[model samples]
Target: MHDVEAPPQERTRFQWWHHSHPTFAGITGFFAGMLFVTALPGAFVGVLRLLFSHDTAEQLFPFVLLALALPIFMLVKRKTRRFAQFMFVGMLVTALVVLGVTSLVLYFMVDA
Candidate 1:
């Protein structure tokens, strides 16, 4: 019998989402989008509270927006899998950038 050479296995880059289920990714994206979206209204409320009323309850009122995530996710996820995944990842990235910039601004503001 003649000796036969075996084919080499293909290597794939390490991607956190690659090993995760699409449903999980989509769900994660939904939550991230919710958090990012909610933060905007929350921030506005917080600023208003700081400027006029000092009520902590009003400042924390934005937490209610978190509940909207489920419906939004359901609507978008039904449209397409790729779109949901992209939206989730995009929201997370946006949150990260916003947080970083805010931190830098606060640091400078406090120092000055």
Candidate 2:
């Protein structure tokens, strides 16, 4: 009887990308998007206050966002680069849209 050889298994194209760059890029993008939508503006205001007037609650949001985004950004930035930027922008836009929709809903609910 002739000996039979087993067929080789094919590897997935995305396996390496997922383990390598794409993973970090996706994460950084998420945090960047969250920072932009939730905390960036507030941080800017907070810094302005430090530069000019007394501190206020408005500044806290930005600082919070920065604290949250920095470490996340650093971890992924070196890996994904442009992919992270795309993710951040897309997420930020989505967040703004949701905020607007929520505000509209609240306004109608209050009026009724």
Model 1, residue 69: what's the lDDT?
72
Residue pairs clashing in model 2 are: 43-62
lDDT of each: 0.64, 0.64
Residue-level lDDT tens digits of model 2 in 1-112: 9987545443354445554565666666667676665666766776767776554655454555555465457447665556556565656677888899999999999999
Off by over 4 Å in 2: 1-19, 54-81
- Which segments of model 1 are wrong by more than 4 Å? 1-60, 75-79
Winning candidate number (TM-score): 2
Clashes of 2: 1
Residue by residue across 8-35, what tens digits does model 1's lDDT show?
4322333334635666556666666766
